[model samples]
Structures are given as C-alpha cells and as structure tokens.
Target chain A: MTRRIFGVRTLGLLGLGLLLVGSYFGLFVAPAERYMGQVQRIMYVHVPCAWIAMVCYTAAFVFAVIGLWNGKPRWDARTTGAIEVGAVLNALLLVQGSIWARATWGVWWDWDVRLTTSLVMLLLFAGVLALRSFVDDSDRRATWTAVATIVAFVDVPLVYFCVRWWRSLHQTQSTPETVSPAMVLPLRLNAIAILLIAIWLIAQRAKLERERLRKEQVDEPARVTAGLEVTDA
Target chain B: MSQERKRRRLLAVVALLIAGGVMAYLAFGGIGENLVYYWSPTELREAGPRAFGASVRLGGLVEPGSIDRQADGLTMRFAVTDGEASVPVVAETVPPAMFREGIGVVVEGTMLRDGHFQTQRLMVKHDNQYRAPEDFKPEDMKELMKSLQFEETGT
Candidate 1:
C-alpha cells in the first residue's frame, strides 16, 4: 500500500515537472512563427494529445494480446483500463483536432483519412466497452476483447499513413531536425511526460478496479447467504 | 510448468509482432504530405537564396504600394516583406476581399527565375476573428482587435 502511494506521488511530481518545462519551452523559449503568430502555440497541446492517445491504444492492444495468450486476469484488467483511458483521450483528440482545424483550416471537420481513422479508433473502443458490459463471463470478455483489440490496432497504421496514402493536406510527422531547437525540446519533454502520465493513470485505474473486484469477491458469499436466509424466512 | 511457460512464450511472440508492426508503419507510412513545411519569410531568406525555380514558401508582410492592380481588377500583384528581405508575389485569383496592404500574408509557390513568387496559393493568414465575407459582419470586424489580442503591433 505504501509503495503504491509512493508510486502515485512520484508520478504526480514527475508530471508536474514535465508540465512546467513543457509550458516554459513551448511558450517562452520557442520563437513564434513568422506567419501564424501565437496561434501556433496550439501545436503544443494538439500534437501531444494525439501522440499520447495513439500510444495508449497501442499499449492496450499489447496487453489484450497478452491476456489472450496467457489467460492472465491481471493483463485483462489492464487491457480494459487502458482502453477506457485511451477512449477518453481519443475523444479529446477529436475535439481538439476539430478546434485546431477550425482555427487553421477554416473548417471544423474534414473527411480526411487521419480524422476518419481516429474516429474509427474511438468507435472501436466504444465497441470493446460494449462487449465487456454484455459479456457475463470474465474469460469470454477477455477472449473477445483481445480479438477486437488486435483488429482495431490495424487502424493506427492506417491513421498514421493516411496523409501519405491519400491526397490529404495534413502535414507529415514531427521530427527533431524539422523543428526549431526551442520547439523540439519542449515537445520531446512533453511527449515523455504525457506518456508517463498516461501509464500512471492506467496503472492507478487498474489498481482501483482490482481492489473493487476483490471486495466484490469477499462480499459475494455473504450476499448469497443473506438472500438464502431471506428466502427461507 | 511447461504449459505455462509455453503460454508466456506465445504472449512474448505476440508482443514482438505488435512492436514490429508499429516499427514498420513508422518507417514507411504516409510517405506523401509529410513533406508539408511551414516557414517564415526570415527563414526562407536565411536559407541563402535557393535556385530560381525551387519551390518554397515566402511569408512576410505584404509591402504597401507594392500591390499593382491589373486592368481586370480581379488579379493583383504584391510584395511580401520581412523588413530585411522582400519577395514579389503575382496572384491571379481575387484577393480574399478583406486582403489589403500591410496585413500578414503567406504566398505559397516556387521562386521564379526573376526572383518573384510564382504563387499557386495566396492566404490572408488571419487571426482568431477575421472571418471571410460569407460570415463577415460589422460586429465581427469590431471583435477583430479583441480576438487577435497580440502584443506586437504590425508596424
């Protein structure tokens, strides 16, 4: 318990540090674009959110595969937890991307492959959650979810390569050499920070789910006996 | 013991497969459109004068009086300046209507043999508020100063 508490506190401090550095570098250190003015600052939030959401989905898919192969209850729980978080982050990404697009592209949405694939990912997560709720047996849920997770992960590559494969206007990947030193440094730091925070959130939520399941297990027999007694009465 | 180890090994292999898929995508995915680059006029100039026909973006202030309206009046020619250097841009399309002298503009095209911009695209590069005439209103114009909210005066 103490170790768990320590882990959460450590992640919090680390996240705070990264946030401060990211904001400083992105806002103050980086030179403003010659054309876009300060609106370019939107890149700081938009890029990281998209990157982290992709990573989260990837992580969840890995765990889903592990759960399927090894039939491990822990991995199953982690898979579900990660997917839940990834879904929320993916939703935020869609919203933020739309906002940035409206500001930059003059339209709130587009039919581009990247946006479509991201929406597909969001729907995939929703589907997985729906499957989990309807399935009564834990093993069945894990098995089906593992299959669904693997299939949906194929969309990540589709999304990443969408611009290249199609004639979309979205720009290419963010590379260290392509960006100003000031901009790249903060972006790299924020990427790491966001990844860590995402992992921490998944871990925390998994732990809570584990504790809840354990409590339910402990109460199950008592509840069954109480029901039997009432029926007899 | 053997069965459990076999299962663990299977999971490990699956993880490796997923990793390999992501790596392959990173290496070769989206080859096109990834080349889209946004540069300031200052940086474009700093690149030390590309070959006359090299495609590049010349971003800067549209120099006053440099605008030459054609007889047709729909087409216009203007120069973008970064205070240090300037590039003349010839735009055939009707300017964004509100597009005028002294505002920020980004002209996308290649540098010509004569050092002018053979612009294929001309963008007004508006701030948060400046909507096009389709949604333009007097009230929206009033909010432009507040919405832009920049400290640097374009003087």
Candidate 2:
C-alpha cells in the first residue's frame, strides 16, 4: 500500500516540475510566433491536452476490449478511470481551443469539421460515463460500458484526421519543417509532463473504483440476507 | 444553508448567461453558414451566377496592394486571389487582428449582383507554419554550439 502511494506521489511531483519548466520555456524562452504573435504560446498547453486526451481514450478502448474478452472486474475499473480522465481533458481541450480561436481565428467557435468532430468525441465518451451510472448490475454495466466505449472510439480517429481530409478553417497539424526547433522543445516537454500527470490520475481513479467494488462485494450477502428476513417475516 | 442555496442558484444563472452569450455572439450566425468552410477563388468563379446572393465563405490570399479602405472607413474593398483566379470583395466588418495583405483569409458573404463579394465577417486563416520574427537560422544554432565547445575547452 505504501509503495502504491509512493508511486502516485512521485508521479505527481515529477509531472508538476516538468509542467512548470515546460510552461516557463513556452511562455518566456521560446520565440513568439511571427504572425500569430504571443497568442501562439497557448499551443504548448492546448496541443498537449488534446494529444493526451486522445491517448487516454485510446487506453480506455484497449482496456474495454480486454474487459469484454475476459470479463474482468479490474479491466472494467481501468476502462472507467481512463474514460473519465479523458473526458475532463477533452473538455479542457475545447476551452483552450476556443480561447486560441478567439485570439487568432477571430472567433470564439466555428463549426469546422475538426472542431465539430472533437466536440462529438467528448459527448460520446460522456455518454459512456452516464450509461455506466444508469445500470445497477456490475457485470452488465461492465459489458455495456465496454461496448459503448468501442463505439465512441470511432470518433477519435476522425477528430485527428478531419483537418487533413476536409476543408477546415483550423490549420493542419504543425511539424518540424513548419515550426522552429526551439518552439518544438517546450511543446514536447509539456506533452510528456501532461501525459505523466494523466497516468497518475488514471491510476488513482482506478484504485478508487476497485475499492468501491470490494465494498459492494462485502455488503452483497448481508443485504440479500436482510431481504430474505423481511420476506419471511 | 438558505444563503448557500441562493448563491448556488445565482451561480447557475451567471454560468448559463456566459455560455449562451458566447454562443450567440460567435456561433448563432457564423457556424451553420460555414459548413463548407471555404471555397477557393477558382470555385467561386466557376460557380458564377449560381454563387450570386448565396451564402458562402470565399477563401484565398489577400492580393498585395488590392486593399482599398473607403474614406468612410466602414467600407473596405480587397481582392482575394488563388493565383489562377481573383475575386474582389467589399467587407463591412473590420478585419481580424492578424489580417493583412498577402495573408490567407476567409470572408463570409454573398456574390453581389454588381460582381463583387460583399462580406460581413472577415477572418484570417493562418498556415501550420510558425517562425520567430528575428529569423534564428540553423547556422546560429551551430555557432551557439561552437561557442559552447570553446568555453568547455578553455575551462
């Protein structure tokens, strides 16, 4: 137990340190964009959040598949954790994108293909969370959650590729050829930092879920016995 | 407890207003009209009369020296060009912060009967490229490395 706690503590500290360093470099050390001016600095946090959000969803997808294949309670807990964390980041990504859009694109929001697909992705995952809550039976909930997650995974790839496949007002993905190496450093640092933080959060959330499952197991027999007593009386 | 509940209610109202206001300001009109995102000058030219008076986003570079801000200030005219074709535009809205000649832009409006694209919303489109204004070339990085090496040797 102490070892597990230590792991989380270490992850949080390391992630915090890297995030501070990355933001410092992004805000001050890195060169401000030419046409975009200082507003482009938002990309450091925004892109990382977007990338990690998708990473969380992808992990959730893999875990859901595993849970479905083997009907494991642990896999269900992990899938739940990943989806919840992914949704939070996805919401943050939209807000950050909106702010960047207002600064650079001259609008708070636009229904461009990429932007629309990302919003749909958030909704689809949020639906999975809601579905999990409505169902009372644990095994049935796990099965349904797994199926819903796999269906939602379809939108993740679309969000990433829509800008390339369609005529979007949002620009295509930036690359080393397009962005300066100096700009790339802080962006990469922030991505790693945020990813570490996400892993820590998912671990904690999954642990909580497992503990809840254990508590429910301990209560199941007593509740059933009480129901029988009332029926007999 | 009553005060806490009242505050919660007030917070909910404020949050709703902020979200609705933002959506109304930016999205209500601008979003659905831009489903196609943008049409190039070539496409607009090909569409011809079919494009007239229909809502569309005409996108291309703002041709250098084509900007004409009427003395009235509210009325500005510019030409959008995609090399092979060019479309003259008269915009009522102020250009975006980064808007300038030679920059890519998407203007939402309609093709007028008078052979001009009349736009109410003018937006700038930035490329996926980013660069420092000071132009830090790769040679500068090599020079920095060489200077660092010299310092190490002297130490």
Candidate 3:
C-alpha cells in the first residue's frame, strides 16, 4: 500500500511538471491570436479541462454499467470516484468558459443551447451525487446511483452536439484542420498532463472508498451480533 | 445459466432499451420545438401575422447607416436585413462594440403590432476567422476600453 501511494504521488508530480511546461509554451511560445489576442491563450487550459471532464464522465458511465451488471462494490467505488472528479472538472470548465465569453462574447453567460445543455449535464450528475448521500443503505445507494448515472449519461451526447444542432454562440469543436500546428502542441501536452492527473486522483479516491468498504465488511458480523443480543434481551 | 436468471437478464435488456428510446424521443421533441430560435428576416416576413406578438429571434446583417441612437443612449433603432428582406428593430439597450453595420447579428424579441421588432437582447455573430490586424493603434484600444466600460456601467 505504501508503495502504491508513492507511485501515485510520483505520477502526480510528473503531471505537474508537464502542466508547467505546457503552460510555458502556450503562454510564451505560441503566437497570439489575431482577433482575440491574449484571451485566446485561455483555450490551452479550458479546452483540455473540458475534454478531460467528458472523458471522466464517460469512465463513470462505464463503471456504472459494470457495477449494475455484476453487482460489484469495486465498480461502484470507481464510478463514484470518477463522478466526483468529473463534476469538479465540469465546474472548472464553466468558470473558465464564462471568463472567455466575457472577453470575446461581451457577456458572462447566455442561455445558448450548448451552454444550457452543459449546465444540465453538470446538474444531473450532481443530483446523482446528492442522491447517493441521501440513501443510508450501502447496497441500495450503489444500485440507485448506478442506475441514475446511466440515465444521466443520456445528456452527454446532447451536450456535445448542442452547438451543431442549434444556433449557438459557442464555437464548434476545434480540430487539426481548424487549429494551427503550433497551437496544437501545447493543447495536446496540457491534455495529457490533465489526463494523467485525473487518473491518479481517481485511483487514490477509489482506493479510499475500497478501504471504507473493507472496514464495513469487517464490522458487519459485530453489528449483527449486537442486534441479536438486543433482540434476545 | 438458470432459466430464471436468463429471464431476468432479458427483462433488464428490454427495460433499458425502452428507457433509452423514450429519452431520445423526448430530447428530440424539445430540440424541434426550439430548433431555430431566430429566423431570417425573409422567414419572419413570410410568417406575417403569425410572427406578430410571438417571441422569436431575428437574425441578419445590420443595415449600414440605419442605426439611430436616441439621446438617452439606452434606446436605439436599426434595421436588420438578410438581403432578401429587412425588418425594423427597436431595442432598449446600448449595442455591443461589434454591433456595427454589415456585421451579422441575432436579436431576440417579438414583432410588435406596429410593424416593428422589439428586441430584448442583441447578439453579434462572429465567425471563426482569426487574424491579427496589421496595426494595433492605441486609439482603437482606447475606444474598445471605453465601450467595455460603457457596457459595464450601462448594464
């Protein structure tokens, strides 16, 4: 266990190093955008964060599916960890996006389809987290959250396609064809950095959850025995 | 697998499929209802009376030399045209810095009974094209700062 913790810490440090290097290139090396100027640099962090958030949500969805199919506590723990991390990243995406919008769009927010759908996705997953906390029974909590996660994931595709489906102020997805090679390097690097950090955090969180489950298992017999004594008396 | 377990798995699959189908239907239905919040001036004109009093968005290029800012600085009148048709718009807010003539814009509001569109919000539509201007004049930067300040104070 100590070795595993050390490994995770090492991975996190590596991610931090990559993030600093990526930011250096993005801020100092990349050419300034013609129209947006310095504000465009925010894309280096904002876009990567958004991408990782989506990836995390997709991971949560996969774990939820496995948990439901097998009724496994391990999968449930993984799903919970992913959802928590994904929600935090999604929130950061919104904040960074709003700052960008203020500089470029001249407004902090708008009820555009893309923005609205993204907000709905965040709220839906947040509701799942809240629901899990409200349920007292461990098995019931796991099952309920797994089902909710699946249902909530239906919004993910809608969020991705909202800009294309409806007239939106938000720009469409940027790809190699749309972005210059010089700009793409930092974007890719930061994406890798964030992805590595997310993986490490999720792994640590899942381990903690598993430990709690293990302790519960150890205490289950004692709890039952105490209940039996009270009933007998 | 036991017969009971097999039956349970089949039931779960069927249930998931039905739920997915229902969700897809509802999502598509919502999108269809608000598909095009704004219509081009030509579309709005074709809708005629149906467009009147109904809250909708009108999108088009702003007509050059048609903007009239009232003395109050809050009330403004302009014309939005899609080349095929034009609509007169009256808005009660200072326009954005990019809200100049020939630029594309989408205004949300409703067509009044008096043959004018009353705008609740005005959004300037910019394309993905990015290029630095040849010159970064200090005066232009000052003008931009002034406009941004005006927006902050006015709103």
> Which pairs of residues clash in candidate 3, taking residues 3 or more apart in a chain or in different chains?
A34-B131, A34-B132
For B27-80, candidate 3 gives per-residue lDDT tens digits of: 566544446646878888999899988788887777878999999888899998
User: Model 3, range A5-101, lDDT digits (tens) per residue?
Assistant: 7888788888889999999999998877756678889999999998998999999988887776766578878898899889988999999989887
List the candidate 3 regions with Cα displacement exceeding 4 Å.
A222-233, B1-15, B22-34, B63-78, B98-102, B129-155
The CA-based lDDT of model 1 is what? 0.64
Ranking by DockQ: 2, 3, 1
- The lDDT for every candidate, in the order shown, is 0.64, 0.78, 0.74
Candidate 1 Cα deviation (angstroms), residue A4: 3.3
Residue A40, model 1: Cα distance from true site in angstroms: 1.2
Residue-level lDDT for A179 in candidate 1: 56
Note the residue pairs that clash in candidate 2. Answer: none
Please state the Cα-based DockQ of model 3 relative to the true two-chain complex.
0.17
Put the candidates in TM-score order, highest first. Answer: 2, 3, 1
Candidate 1 per-residue lDDT over residues A46-117, each given as its tens digit? 788788888888888888777777666677778878888888878988988787665554446655456787
lDDT of candidate 2 at residue A233, scale 0 to 100? 6
Compare the candidates by lDDT and give the number of the best one: 2
